[model samples]
Target chain A: MTPLDCVEGKGLACVRGGRTVFRDVGFRLARGEALVVEGPNGSGKTSLLRLVAGLLPAASGTLWVSGGDIVIEEREERGKLIGWLGHHDAVKPQLTAAELLRFFARLQGTRAQSVTAALERVGLSCAADLPCQYLSAGQKKRLALARLKLCGRPLWLLDEPLAALDADGKSLLLTMMREHLATGGLALVATHDPIDLEAARLQLA
Target chain B: MSAFAALLARDIRLAARAGGSAMLALGFFAAVVTLLPLGIGSEARLLASIAAGVLWIAAVLANLLTLDRLFQADYEDGSLDLFALSPLSLEGIAGAKIMAHWLTTGLPLTILSPLLAVLLHLPAAAYPALLVSLLTGTPAISAIGAVATALTVTVRRGGLLLPLIVLPLLTPVVIFGAGTVLASIDGLQNGGIWFLAAFAGVTLPLSPFVAAAALRLNLSE
Candidate 1:
């Protein structure tokens, strides 16, 4: 696992669908630091996080993670450093919650024990055996949270992490985010809603 | 279990759960083979003559119908991005998907084709050649078809567009596959089987990389 000391991008710019989303955006984040990206809809908050995650290549500029430059197919960077939570729920409706977590654990090259631990942590033990199709929207978001915690990556790129979450679900995520920061993990969360935590804010116009 | 094994197993299990693609392809293949007698003349000599081409064409189209399901489901459910994040390379994931696709569709078709050959009035002498040709040819079709399947994964109605792209690329496999059986009936040396094997050999390794590259393009878009 990479010990995250700092992630800083220089002059970041994003282009999508032949239009520039954001240009000349730059920042540096270190261990135990959080950056909450706030912006209006279509203002490139999600695009910014995706660019850092290497999902969307930056139109220009460099994103450096722990002193290593971001590359699209770098397995070590993607597998160990980045844990992404995009808008679309990645869980398969056909697989049971436990089965899905186990599959993800295997994909992350981690132990299956983390799957059970994360499920319990997220209060999903009761619904563990049920297929994801039966999961309500809130329960499905919790499942995605369980997967993020279970994977154990050092950097999180969360896009709208609180959408569809209940009060309990929101608190659970805040705790996870806190624990992640305390343990030297870095986070860049994009949302238009208020996050009641002490975080460095980057607002995109 | 290894990541590749898990992915391959999961894909096959999912296809089995989907419940229609593999079974539908089989039903379609059987119907085409069965209807051939009515469409053409019922003469035994004529049926025997065209049996090779007819059976090969049916199997190809039947297999083609399921190709769209290969990557679209993963792409839609957002697992494809998670797959890109895994320790396994995209190429490895593509290979696992294609293997699962072959196991469910191509492998079954190859096994069932010889049985359908009897309905087509295929001579007993041509049976072994038919089996060998399909065994070599099916993997090539799966591997090559996967490339086009991955390309159209982002398009909404790409399933309908699959045949347009795939049929032209896989025409050689069909030609070589049918040629192997025809050469067997004519009491001539069939070098076509060697060409069929070589096509499988070349495609099985190379196509996954091409498919993976296309999927990455789709993911970023």
Candidate 2:
């Protein structure tokens, strides 16, 4: 049941904009565990997450998720097992929260949830019918988090999940992470702030 | 059916709910077609000669206007990344998006071309030829536009650059499309439809893969 056993990376490097963001970076996460990637603004935390999520190629090493090696050949299969959320809330502004969640659920090949349940999980139940463009900043972040609840994937790659949250929103997210890990789901969250989790720290310098 | 249907349905619903860009594109197409005959002299022979080219050109422009939104909005909102990461390959997503684009922009343009043709004083017999050529050519427009849209997703001023990149590539389509209608008007239909069909067939399969690759490069950047 070791988290590292299920998720692992080795000698991973990423370059962007004619500069090497980080090189030889590596880490792992497992069920019932969380790995917090702490770094400064330009320290390649998001790049590392993208590499792990198989969104970008690693310059040098390999990433493995849930016992599957993340080579080019296994990318499609690996994608199904990873749920990634970046700092930019990717929700379509024209879509109601309900429609957005339903579309994403179908994309992930999962049954659509009661939008009520998903929205309520992120404290967005009252705004479920509202298009995302009209939601407040924190509300938008919550709407993005609601995707995590809807997809129910085992691995979560979150970049600064707590950036725009108020205190209550942060607490709600912390609780969500605990619940996720308690259920044998793993999370790799990249952030600057200290997250209240009994989690291992992975510093990307 | 296949996952392609699901992707198409989702995009069409998204497009429909978002103020119906397809119908709006058709409206633009009609407006452009109507204005051309007014701008130029309305002599019957002149209109008949230029009608197909004008209609196809207007349709291509209208399609380009809506093309930027094909990937730009999705990329801005982060749904493009999600689509990229889907179990469906990027090429599959590109194909679905192109189909949606054609359904929204191209199909309406083709449907409305005949109406515009009449207003432009085009010969009655040329209507069917114009329609057939548009049916074959507009998909190529959508497919080629997808490649440009994907390439310019991360670039600033992509809206302006879209047509600049795509229009040159659309030369063959315009040539064949306009040629087909003119040939019909001249009572010669031997090669135009086949040429149009061949252009569509070749571009449809090839453009999606190129678009997918371009999107991957843009995303990775």
Candidate 3:
């Protein structure tokens, strides 16, 4: 059940702030599989994620997602297929857990669910009604993960998904990843710590 | 259709939850209009003479109040990144945001213009033209503000810089917006409304592209 079976890159290079970040760097993640990108700060882990997500241009390379050209030319289509969570939590602090999920779901053209379903999936049902600004760090991360349950995109590009998670939260995310892969979904995660995934590892030095 | 609607809905919901900045903007517009008569002589004739100009200036200022939050909140929360990665073109997203901004800021201002106009003693006949011009022109202000919002997304003190970046570009909106009211007051049916409508037509389609490009650059940086 290869959800994403095609290669998606080309001798890609990126230069940032007048310095070369990485060159000829590339990898692929298919359904039931994952790619864990480990790197130190400023080593282009996030940049590579952005590049794959089509948020940033490669200084010099090509990207193909599921065999489709990765030119960001069709953003709405790409958005439906890929879910990207960057270093910063993108949740609007003023919105409640339920409101945030509904907002993203609507943007993705998916039907809005009871915020309870999303919050419960992420174990935040108790805090669903609280504004994001009031949530604890780990709780905020959980709310963001709830988006995955509601969004149902094929590819997940997570930058530091484990950043502020407690041990329990981290384990919950690992379980979620396994579930995602079991369903033939693909993931590309950039993290500083090693992630427990039965998938290939790409180290950026 | 759904995508645009979703974007608009999400933004409006967020704005509403955050305290209804639209009403605040309108209140600010009203306040600004009220204060002018105090600073300048309160003579009815003098107020009537500059009524259109004062309303237009207040409208622009009111719109600027929410401009900094347009992309900054999304950028901070990472929704901007998701938006950047979504299959929707950045241009479309920018356009959706501009529309949302107009709904939240411009629409309220337009509605309140009559009340402010009465306060300013604008000629009775000028009210319709003034309201119509505002309806057409404020969208242009929101669109132009998108570019400035994108440019200043990564800046530390974007709130202060927003006006600096947007005021110059907003000059056209001010000119045409104020010009139409003046024409209406003078009983001279001029082309100000046409010029304003055309300005919105051009900027509505084009400014989003500029904003999208700028967002791409800022996010890349």
On a 0 to 1 TM-score scale, where does candidate 3 land against the true structure?
0.92
The digit string of per-residue lDDT tens for model 1 on A1-205 reads: 4666788889999888999999999988988888999999999998898777777788898877763443434543554578888888888887889988998888788889878788999999999999888999888889999999988888888989999999999999999999999998889999999998788999899
List the candidates' TM-scores in order.
0.93, 0.94, 0.92
Candidate 1's C-alpha runs over 4 A off are A67-76, B18-20, B41-43
DockQ (0 to 1) for model 2: 0.58
Per residue, candidate 2 scores C-alpha lDDT tens digits across A1-205 of 2122378888998988879999987776666789999988899999988888778888888776654343334777677767778878887777788888888777767777566788888878888788878998888889888887777777888999999999999999999989888888888999999888888998877
CAPRI grade, predicted model 2: medium
RMSD of each: 2.3, 2.4, 2.6
Q: Which 10-residue span in candidate 2 chain B carries the lowest summed lDDT?
A: B1-10
Q: Each prediction's Cα lDDT score?
A: 0.86, 0.83, 0.83
Which rank order by lDDT, best down to worst?
Answer: 1, 3, 2
Stretches off by above 4 angstroms in model 2 are A1-5, A68-73, B1-3, B18-20
Model 3 chain B TM at 0.96
Error of 3 at B15 (Å): 2.5
Error of 3 at A25 (Å): 2.7
Q: Of models 1 and 3, which has the larger TM-score?
A: 1
